[model samples]
Structure formats: structure tokens, C-alpha cells
Target chain A: MNRIAQGLTLVLLGAAALTSTVPTDLYLNWVKPGFGPFLIAAGVVMVLLGVLVIVAELRGGDQALDQEDVVPSGAAAAGDDGPARSELDHAAAEYAGHTGDGHGHDHERAPGVAWLLLLPVLAVFVVAPPALGSYTVESTGGSSGPPPRDENGSSRFTDNLSEAAPGEVVELDVQQFVMRAWVDEERELADREVELTGFAVPTEDGEGWYLARLQMACCAADAVVNKVLITDHPAPEADTWWKVRGTWVEPEGELYDASEHEIDTSSVEAVTDPPDPYE
Target chain B: MSERTTPERGSAPDPATSLGDTIAGGWDDRGDELPPADWGRSSSSRRTGTVWLFALFITAMAVAHAWLTDDLTGQAFLAWATIFTAISFQALPFLVFGVALSAALVAFVPTSAYQRFIPSRPGRAVPVAGVSGALLPGCECASVPIAGSLIKRGVAPAAALTFLLAAPSINPIVMIATAVAFAGQPEMILARFAASLLASVVIGWVWVRFGRADWLRLPSRTHAPNASKWEVFRESMVHDMMHAGGYLVVGALAAATLNVMVPREWLMAVAEAPVISVLVLALLAILLSICSEADAFVAVSLTDFSPTAKLAFMVIGPIVDLKLIAMQAGVFGWRFVARFVPICLVVGLLSTFLIGGILL
Candidate 1:
């Protein structure tokens, strides 16, 4: 891309980054909610820097597109109908000299793949995807049965907080619930009718479906899918929100099969998608 | 796109036509009255092209929104998009910081500053750079360009590589995160720090010893003398962003794809045997391409693994990974990465094993 195009892109990038984090939690779909303000500031700086470059280019301050690209393309310098200008338009095509096809813009120095950077920009600015679901989990093979953390490690949980008091149907995080059900030898959750929340997802094995919650340990990149198989109920329409009252059942299938962890359904209720989809 | 129709730009005497002028002075003009064509190069075409592309991209997004609103393919695409955008968003601040710092070094920082602090010898420079990395709090994504700038600035390549390897792995933010992730086991943090530092210095010396200058592809350090310092600074920042941002996308794509595609079961399966588990976790670290500051949480989550294996995971991750590989390929060419990655991996794994064996 030309310096002008690069500057405009930076300006757009800054605007996108800043807006994604502000006035709403829209950015939460892509990043941690806590990271919003820093992103806003970065966006602002990028915008300013972009403006600086644009003003410089407008004054013809920049002499060359870049000091040195791997392969300096069509250095036409707009000189007397330099035919090479057409060849230079493939900004990113020069990288590794991969494909010489006329795919890039007509800028001599702009990185050709520079256009691909807009893919994410368009994605965030437009239809922000929801948190990851079971499909990602199944595809990544992250459904590695329940972790063996039998000992509850939530520093948030205190001694007096014991199991669901009587039959109150205590609500639990799907992650905590799964961990407790699988290894809580005390059978703390065995007889308790616990409330759980998540969107419905199709099971990978095709035998059943799961009520799954996607958790982001860090960012969306590190999203972990925590699932509880709903044995008695067919999966609700994909990604439908539900609040279920269920009892933990003995796992079935191979010892290591993640699908073995099932929830015996007592009741299932429809709910709107929660603001925070992760545990 | 606007350039296509600009007849004025085509009519101007192309300074670049003469190979001598293109080589000596790319855009520098000796004439008193500037060519109107110079203005054409920066004219309405650029703005119009940007606006046109902007409208096209938005229309495409609208179509995508409709498709995503109703289809599963849209959902899958969104999943991929979120991961992709999250990476660029996260890297922006670091990119800003790095470019500003590199630009400041070029503009304000004097040659005396390097003479005063940095040693010329590779043996001493490697340690100095490795230790100085404690100062930078940015991620590996930020380091590639900064390292590139450092090399362009005349710092020894080995020293810059040391800084590159050390900054993301041992910086305070990363160390603290490692501590938090491995809380109650302070020793894991120590092991990671020592191992990562050791790995870095080892690799640096290896570069000093065996690295061929021709094999490393670097941007020329030449500067346009006529450009103002502010102009230079802005150029530095924009140039680095454009070059690094593209590869960051590539790296992020690999990270996101590998993250979902690599079965966690396989990682967990090999957790029983210590030797195999160390290799497995180290390989997983390369695949995960997670930020070093945040990887501790991931390591901690793998509860069944031995602490040594976790150390291997943390040490290897920042120094070498799919993301780092992509960035390296972008900045230094594939040849450099071909030789550099295997060497770093072997060194990173070996150091982690030795240190973890003793410390854990």
C-alpha cells in the first residue's frame, strides 16, 4: 500500500481499536473486559501516529514508502509513465516472491498481506462473534475429560460455604460443578439438585449433546470449553441459553472419554444469553 | 486505486527512472520549485481510494453479518475472527510502545548512550542485553520489530537476539505472572527464569559463534538525511507497524488454529512419563504461542503435569513458537528461522530440563 493508504489504514485501525473498547463491552467478545481502556489508549495513539504520517505524506515529507522492503517493488517515483508502477501495486506479493499475481493494491511498498490485516478489523467492527462453543472444543480435542482437581481450589470458597444448604438448588459455575461432581468423594453434589447455566451445543460423538460454558482463562485465544453432557435431553437448538436443574450421574463410556461425564436432568428452563458467557 | 486515473502523476518526470537517483536519493528533490506531480502522489486519489475501500469492506461485513446471523459457518468464522482480532488488539499497545521506544532511540538517544552502556564484545553484550531485557514489559509480539530496529540501529545481532529471547520470558510482568500462576511453588518461577535466561545466552553465543551474516535477512539501516527528526520518528513507527502488523496476523492465525486443533487429550496423555511429558509440554508451548506473562496460568491449569514439565513449557514458549516463527519468517526471512528455531528449541529444552531437574 502507499503511504497514504497506510496512513488511512492506521487511522481506521486506531478508530476501530478505540471504539471496540468504549461505550459498551462489545470488545469482551474478543478480549478480556479488563483490557478495554488500555486498548482505547493504544487506539488513540495509533490514530495520532497515523495522522502524523498522513500529514507528512500530504506534504510529500516521506521520500520512500519504507526505508527498505525485502524486495523494493516498482520504484516508479511517478516518473514519466513508468510502466513498473503497475507491477508495484502488489504490495505484499514481494514477500518471499510467493505469487506474482496482481492481487495487491497498486502501491509499490505496502506489504501485500497488509490487506489481510483488515479481516480482523472488519470482524471486530461488524458482527462480533460470541464466545467459543463446543465445535471449537471438539475440533481442538480440548474435551480431555474432567481434570483431576478433586480438591476444590477456589480461594473464594470458605469452610462455612459447604455444599448446597438443604435443597435450595445452589447455583454453581459449570467448571466448578464438573470438577466437584467428578472427584468430590464426599458426594457433596451427589444428591443436591444444582442449577447450571450455558448455551446448548451439539456433542461431537453424535450420540448426545452438551450444556457447555466457554471460559476464557486469559483472552478469547485461550478460551476453554467446559461442558456437561445432557443425557436425558436432546441438545437444545445450538447456542440456545438454558438454566438446568440436574443431578450428577456416574460417568459412562471409556474411562478417559470426556463424554462420559453426564448430567441426569431433573428440569431444564430457557434463559436469555448471559452477559458473561464464561465461568 | 486512485493512482490509476491520475494523468498528472503519469506525466511528471519520474526521478526513479534513473537508477543512480533512485539509489542515492529515493524521494529527495534538489530542485527549487517542487513538481505539482509530487502533490498528485499525495492527492485526492489516496483519500478516495481509502474511502472507496472502506465502503466496500463495510458492505462485505454487512453481508457477513446477515450470513452469520443465520448460519453455522458464520459462527465458525466468528470464532476464528475473535481469536484473530483479540491478538491484534492485544498487540497494539505493545507495538505502540516498541515503535515509540525504537523511534526515540533513533531520534533523541545519542550514539554516546550506546558507548556508555552497551559493550562491544559478544560475550559481554549477550549478558548485558539479556539482563537489560528485565526492563521491557512487552510481549513476544512486540519484541520482533523492536529487535529488528535494534539490529538496524547497529546493536550486535547476537545481543539483540538475547534481548529478543529474554524480554518476553523474564521481564517483570512475565515473572510476576509466572509467580502468580505457580503460586505456593516459588521454585517454579526460579526455574523458569534461570532456564529462560540460560537458554537465551546460550543461543546468543551460538549465534556469535556460528551465525553467518549472509543468512540473516535484515532491513537496510540507511536513513534519509533530509527528513526531520519528527519525520524520522513517525516514519520509524509507521514502517515498523506496517511490516510487523502483517506478520502478527499470520502468527495469530497459527496460534488460534493450533490452539483449537491440537487435542488437549494428547497433551494430557503423555503427562505420565516425565521425559516424554517434558518434550510434550515444550512442544505444546510452541504450539500455544501464548504470551509469556499469561502462560503460567495455562501451565498451572495442567495440574497433572510435573513442575519440571511446566518449566519446560514456560521457557520454550516465549523464545520459540508458531507465532514467533511466523514473525521471524516475516522479519528475517525463512532461512534465518530455519536455522534459528531448531537451535533455540534445542537450547531452550535442554536448559529447562537441566534447571528444572535441579530446582524442582
Candidate 2:
């Protein structure tokens, strides 16, 4: 029973890992894209291990059983004939020693606690939870903007912000928009019309919604929210994706002092979710 | 099954045999034969039961999911599930790599090799092991089983335990990730290395002074010398994966729940105070249970907290977190974890503050 449970658990986990990464891009919602090959390799290894276990059990069962009946009694009677005994007899003796002490090490079996592995197998294969959306952003209290500047008072994004020709709308992701809005000392985004895409999050006051996106370092578990308040535009339904053209509205504070960044929207259009939901 | 039971029944009536002798002799004779026959017989019966239970579980989940889909759309419960699945999925490959390496050590490496390499004295060996942690480049999940296997191979408990605490934090991959996360602040990377090394060594020394052998249930060595190395490797790898993966699931559940349920405002409220912020971030590290490689990015996001408090978060996270605590209790006994976790936590905090004060 324990052997079957162990083998089944391995196979199930392997299958779950494979299905998550192989056929679809479901794993992207959970981890970074670079993890694809590693997860697939791990899955193959697990499945091979599980199959090897079952095969070994089937092939060796009867022969080992026949050997067991003769070896133990023979070894016990001729206890002093240690050097004369075969290697199989020596292994049987070690197995006896393990079982003699109450700490019997079942070489082929797993602990009962291992049955809990079914939980993740069920979760991944059955529930199939979606990616983090507007709920996470609101719950985590929205974006804290970008990291502070270095001691030299320079920002990485400063040089990347090129001067745009007048009336040309620049395209930026929600992350870059929030970063420049907070740390860019030149106020480069203030006069330039820019385009950003994110899922909508309705504001509490019912005036205008926040355009929000989650940025993760490794996986969804460490994801943080980056959002911009879209003022003067009507609120869209929560979590619906949209592309908005807007000009940055300079807030009343020094850089990194303001809790929120606002953008005055010129136009709003409903759009499908992006291929990569996170930045 | 019937044929196997006949011998057992015949052997049971020996009046000359004492119960202990009968048990030991019977187990010795039947160990190879009975387990296989029993496994074959029980598996067929149990497989059906398992299949039925699984179908019922799926059906129930389908019903619940259908009912809850509308209400749970963009809700906290869905958020919790996403985080839980993400953590488990992200950690799974690293855990597999760790168990595979651990199994190789048990099967391929000779026990004598450990004694010949490590110093005899616990004091000298502890720092040696701590410094050697930089060799392993994987995250925290990989180190726990490797540490457990190191102890199994006769390395000193203090030295192996020190390796566990230090490997995840000071490794090259984690350091690079930290450097990228705190891009311009080279001091943060140096401080992390110094603080993690100091804390790991200090905790190892403390263990050498105060720890008891009986508190830790040393991992049992498996497979006799006569067994093939491939057989030993396969057996140990499967066993360790089953054992550790279950605990990983437990850790993921706790972290996910805390991630969704704990309000960000509470952490923000304490971010301004110097001493309280450090303590708060330390506690937050335990609760968040973020992987050490990714934790720097999360630390950078906490713009409200001081560099010292962020240092505490980074230091305490890799060494002592909900996931590590669960894995430790699974590998070592609960008694060992109860003592070991607190010691690591306190040492990690003190080392962080000391290093952060000096550098930042």
C-alpha cells in the first residue's frame, strides 16, 4: 500500500508539473518564464523515478521472497559463519537489524504524512487559480512607487527617458510610468502625452479608477502593485483590461514624497489582456 | 496472498519460540517476501478506493468552484489560491534538485570522505561549513535536505546546521539577485554577505555549546552496502521527495494565507520607528516566507522602511521563515526546530543590526 501510494504521488506530481509548463503557458502566471525548462526536466525525472520503482517491485518480488524464507533462519543458526554468507544474506541481516530496533526503516515505503502531497496535485490540476488581478492591488494598498535613488542621487530610468516631439504619444508600461512619475527629477512625463495598458481598479470615491499592474521579482507570491490614478475619466468595471492615452499630472510634492501618481486621461479604449499580465 | 499467509500460519505455532524471538525471526524470514505480496494484494484494492476518493474530491471541487466563481472573481480567496499555487510551483524544481543532490551524497559519497575533509573540532568545523555554503547556488528549499544528508554522512551537527542557514543567503545567485534589486547600493550586497555569515557561524557555535544529541532525530541511513548504488540513489531520492514535498505544501499554505489576510497598512504603521521597524520586518520575514533569491526585490519595494529594517528582513528571511520552519520540523524533529529556529532568528536580527549600523 505504501509503495503504491509513493509511486502514485510521484507520478501525479510529475504530471501536474508537466501539464503546468508544457502544453500551455499556465506556469507563467505562477513563476518567471526562465523556469520553463527546469520545471519540465524535474517533471521527467520524477516520472522516470516513479516508473522505475514500480518496475523494480514487479520484477524482484518473487525471487526476493523465496530468498527471504531460507536466508534468515540459515543465518541465525550459523551465526558465526559471517564470511561464508552470500551478499544477499548480508543484506537480509542488515534488514533484520533495522526491524529489530523499533525504528524499522521501510526502504520501499514512504511516511504516512506524504499523503498530503495530493493537496497540491489537486490544487494545480483542479482548481487552476487565475493570475493576480485588481483584488491583489487594492488589498496590498496599491503601489509604493519605485525604489529610492542611490546616494549619488541618480536614477536608472533618467537617461532612458528620451525627449519626445510635441503631441506624439509615448508608450510605457504601468511600471515605467509609475517609476518615472515618482523618481524622474526633470519632470519629463509632465507635458508629454503617453499611452499605458493595465487592468482597471475602481477608486473608493467613485470619481475615477486606478490603472494597475503587478510586478513580480520571481513569482506571483512576491508580486507588488504599481498603479496610476486616472483622473477625469469614468471608472471602468474592475479588472477589465484597457489601453489609455494620458498626460502626466504633476502632484504637489517633491519626488518620492507623494503617495500616489496621477495621469489626466485623454481617451480610453477597452482591450484584451496582454500576453504577459505582469511586468 | 493466500500462499504467503500459509507459511506465516505454519510458523506461528512454534511453542519453543519466545514472542521477541518469533517476531525478529519472522520479520527476518518474511521481510522480502511478505512486503511484496502484501503490496501487490493491497495496492489493487487500495487503488480503486483512492481513485474513487479522487473522483469525489474533484467533483466536489468542481461544484464549489462553479458556485464560488462569480463571488470569488477578484476576491481575496482567489488571490490566496494564486499565491499558494505560485509558491508551490516555484519551489518544486529547486526541491527536486536538492533531493537529487542529497540522494547522490548518500549513495555515491563515502562516509569516510566527510570525516577526512571536515575538522574534528566543532568550533573550527562550524565556520568551515558556513563558509562552504557559498558553493551551493540554489535557494533555501535546496539546503534543508542537503544539510540533513550532511549530518547523516557523519558531518558535525553544528557544521551541517550552519551550512543550512548560510547557503541560501550568501550564495552567488542570491547575491547577484540582491545586487540587481538594490542596483546602485553595493553596500547592501556586502552587508548581506557579512551579516549572514556572522549569524550562521554564531548560531553554529551556540549549537556546539548548548545543543543536545537526543533533541535531533538524525536521518536514518538506508540500503546496505551490498545494494547497488543506483538502487540506493533511487530509493533515497523518492523517499526524501515524498517526505519533504509534503512539508513544502504545508509551508506554502501558511505563506499564502498570511499574504492575503495580513493587511499592508499594519506593516506600514510600524515602518517609521527605528527599533520597531526592524523587529516588525523580522517578523514579516517569517510570515512572508519569500524565497531568498526573490526577497531582495520585495525588500526594495518597501520604500517606507529604513535600510536597517530592510537588512533585517533580508537576513531573517533566508534563515528563519515559515517554510524553513516547516521543512526543519519535517527533517529534524520538532524539538530541534523549537530550539534552532529561535536561536537563528535572534542571531540573524542582531547580526543584521550590527552590520547594517556599520555599513548603511
Candidate 3:
């Protein structure tokens, strides 16, 4: 039994290391794209654990058997084969209900069926499936499609650039228009739009930006958003909800603010309930 | 010389007389009748050999898989490894808990305890048992054995059957997981709860009206309420662990086959309407036999389908997947499993569709 246990453990471990070359039947075709890598890790763990468990059980059983074998043979010849009873054994002999004694219940020991688990267990380890990908992403569009579009042609923004006069209260809702004042339409307030209302989130460039509402079909876990890069602006504490009505500037190319220096703009007030909220 | 037995028995205290006196003393004479002390050792060795043979078989298969799949593309290798690991790791702790619990139930609980929980009226017992499932939480794989034990202990068939169906779904852990999976979308959770509850209740009633008591098998012995819980627990856990573990292995293999053989690109080509949607996913769920705990993660990833369709997948897989059907068949009679699975599948499908449509 010990040799067999050892042999079994070694073979499984070795199998875990062996790379299967069968191309067609090995990998699943319909699995999600990124799911494969994770599957492999899981398989290796399973194979190792399965072997460890069997080996441990085998060793434990062997030791118990060895101890039983050590009982003196002379006692057997004297017609006393059972082990010497201990005081603890007597104490422990509280009459528990019948434990498998004379129960006619036909519970068959599964001698061979347990091995059946191996085939599938091994298969899953060997043929790790892939994760969901672009197809899934693309298929998930609806009234739940991309975020709500602003009337100003931008799909995910608060307001187009609109220059506000100094001390002008632009009265921003933070949910509607883009921040910048640009294009042929907003040519009136171009070059100085200010203070929009939204959440303060970090931009991809590691700088602070005011990112506004975007509705996702699912939960916030998959929320898509639109951002307006704010430079020369005092960083609005990250994740703080604030209502800012700042001058919108088209700036030069696609740059967010023309104020080169981080805008230490004033009138950054935190407010609740922006009207006409998107999402 | 102490009691030279045989040939007048050397005044061995009249071995057959005195009735109960010297009960242990009588065993002294019997013990010497054996050829040797090592008689049982050979049997133990044989059993050990069998266990090893099984292990070796598994190892050989693994080696074959590795050799055959060695040439798999980088994507393929990653795919294989990730899925294997996820299932292996994700299911281990739960399996351990469930097996241990089942063992405890068997070892400790008295046969009559099952009756205590059973309702007096057929009319009353069925629904109570069905709804009472909220109390015990786990997968169907674990539930079947518990249900079987109850049946053996004289639990009302209808009630036990209801419990068998509903315990896996109505449990708090599953409900909470469903709620979180949908993420703030309470509607999905609501739909699931309503659908599952309705389906289970319906099944309970149907079982009461039409069930055959003989369909289920009972354990050989009746248990006393005073039975030691720990002993029962150990036995149940060991027995059930083997059964559930065996089924899980079956499921994983089938899932792997579907995963490897079916191309994702081709699956996407299918239509996404309710009919096509239900059919495809139902088939997949049947074939894949993913565990109920992990099915949610899989559901979240099936982005191509409607929320309603995915709901059907989740609801149906646990109730009537290929591996589950097989396990049920093995434990219960095939005739019983055959009738129960299809009924459950239909009910599961219809309820999921109706509920998902309204909510999603």
C-alpha cells in the first residue's frame, strides 16, 4: 500500500508537469478570452492537492496498521487477541446509539467508483478554459448602450467649452454640457468656461480631473465615465463630490484648460442633487 | 495452564453455561481458534492496494492529457490552467464544510428527529418543508443525501422532496450571493427569489398530489433521538463527501469537454432571442454542470445573453444539469430521477424566463 501510494502520488505530480500536445481536444473553443491563464493555475493546485491528500491518508493508515501489528503474539496464543483495555476506554464507553451495529442498511462501500472523479478532475486541469472578452463587451449595448450623449454632440461630457465672464454664475448642473467652451456654436463664451459640478477622480495622467456622470447597464462596478482634465486647478480632494461652475476654455488643441498653471479657481462648492442627472 | 479448551474444555467454567456470566471469558476460547493474529492484515493490505490502483489510474490519465496537450497554443495553455485552478480552489472549502455537515447529520441526529421537523398534515408539511429550506444552505449535491436520510427516517415524502429541491436555492448565502452578483440590482435578486420560491412551492404541491412513497429508498435502521451527534456527523460527512466529490469530478470533466470542443466565435453566431437563448444556455448548463457557487461568476461573464437568459442558466443548472442528473440517478432509482429532472427543468426554465423578463 505504501509503495502504491507513493507511486500514485509521483505519477500525478509528474502528470501535472507533463504538457499535453493534443491541440484540438486540449483547449476549449468558446471560453472567455482571459479565463485561460487562471484555469491553468487552478489545475496545477488541484493535481498537487489531490496527490497530497491520498499520500497523507495512506501514511496515516500504514502507521495505525504497524502499531496494530506490534501487539505481542504470545497474548494471541494465550487466547487473548484483543488489546489490553485502558481506564480511558472504560470511561469513554458511554452507550452511544447503535453505530453501524446490526443496521440492515445496505450501504455499499464504493471501492471502484471513487476513481471516476479523476477523469474530469484531470480534464479540467489540462484544458483550462478562456475568459469572456471583446465579443461579450460588444454585445452588451442598449438603452443601456454607451453613456448618455450631451446635446453638444459629445456623448459623455458635462458641457462644451463656454467662456464665462469674470464673476459670472454660469449655473452649471454638472450632469449636462461639456466643460470646455469651443466649437463654432459656443464661440460666444469661448476661452473662459469655469466651475462645473461632478466627482473628483484622477485622470489617466495621474493628475486630478472632474469626471461626471455615465450610466452603465449593470452596476457601478462597470460604470463608464467622461472626464475633463483640469490643470492649474487646485486638486479637488479625490472622490469628493463637488459643484464647480468654472469658465470653460477650448484651450489650444484638445488640451483641457488654457491656464497652463494648475487652476486654483474659486467657487468650488459641494452640492447635492444636480437636476437632469444622467444615469 | 489456564483453561485448556477443547476435549472436555479443562474445566473452562462450562463455556456454554451460566448464560451471561463470563461473557468476556468465553471470548478467550474463541480467540485461539484463529489460524494467526495477522488474518485481518491481508484484507487491509488488499484495500490499500485498491486505493493505490485508483490513484495510479488517475495519474496515468493526467500524464496522457499533458502529453497530448503539450502542443497547445499559449492561449490554450492559459485557458486550461486558469479554469482548472479556479474550480479546484473555489470548491474545496465548501465541499469540506458540506461533507462534514452531512456526516454529522448522519452520525449524531436520531432517525426520529426527521419526523419532528415534518409537518403533521400532508397539506401543511409540503409547503413548510419547501419554505423551511431557507434554514439549511448548501448546494443540491449535498441536499440529496440529507433528503435521502430524512426519507429513511420516515419524513413525509412530499416534505422531504420539497426540501431536497429548495434548500440549495433559498439559503441565505446563495440569495445574498445572487444579490451581490447583480450588484445593487435588487431586482435580479427579487426575481431569483420569487422564481425559485414559486417553483419550489409548485413542486412541493405536485409531489403531495402525485408522489409515490415507494420511489425513495430508506436506510436500514431507525435512529434514536439520543444518538450521539458527533458519531452520526462523522459517518454522514465521510459518506456524503465521497458522493458529492464523485459527482463534482463528473461535472468538471463534462464542463471541460464543452469548454474545449465548442468555439466561442461559433457560439456567438446563435440568435439571442428568448427561445434560442434558453435552449443554448440550458444545453450548456446541462453539459457543463458548473457548481452552483461558481455559476454566478460564469453568468456575469456571459455578456452576449440577456439578463433573463442568464438567469435561466443559473436557475436551471443547479436543478437539472447532466452531472447532477447522473448523481441523482446513481443515488435514487433511475425511474425516479428521470421523472423528477425533466419536471424540474421545465419549471425552472419557465419561471426564470417569466421572472427575468419582468425584472430585467
Best candidate, TM-score: 2
Candidate 1's displacement at residue B159, Å, is 1.9
> How many clashes (backbone atoms < 3 Å, residues ≥3 apart in a chain or on different chains) does model 3 have?
79
Q: At residue A228, what lDDT does model 3 achieve?
A: 47
Per DockQ, the best of the predicted structures is 2
Cα lDDT tens digits for candidate 3, A1-279: 232333233223223322221222222222222333433443333333333333333333444335434543223233221233222112111111112222112122321334454443354444433332222222222111222112344332334334445555565433233322322233344434455555665444556564454432222112233344466566665545566655554455543323221233455677654432223
Deviating ranges (above 4 Å) for candidate 3: A1-108, A119-279, B1-45, B51-85, B217-232, B356-360
- Tell me how each candidate scores on DockQ against the true complex: 0.22, 0.25, 0.07
Off by over 4 Å in 1: A62-108, A125-127, A140-170, A182-194, A202-209, A230-235, A245-267, B1-76, B265-274, B303-306
lDDT for each candidate structure: 0.68, 0.76, 0.49
Q: Which ten residues in a row are the worst by lDDT in model 1 chain A?
A: A87-96
In model 2, the Cα lDDT at residue B112 comes to 79
Q: For candidate 2, report its TM-score.
A: 0.85
Task: Look at candidate 3 and tell me the lDDT of residue B205.
Answer: 75
lDDT of 3 by residue, B1-360 (tens): 111222223222221222122223223323322333234675345544554455445455446556755654454444444444334333433454555555555555665676577776767887788788878877766677777555545566667777877887677777776764565467767876777776777777777788665454333322223434543453344444445555555555455545545655554566367578767877777776676655654565565677777777777776777667766654454567767887888888888878877887
lDDT of 1 at A125: 49
Native-contact fraction for each model?
A: 0.33, 0.42, 0.12
Shift in Å, residue A238, candidate 3: 36
lDDT string for model 2 (B115-182, tens) is 89899798999999999998789888989989878877777888999999999989999999999888
In order of lDDT, best first, we have 2, 1, 3
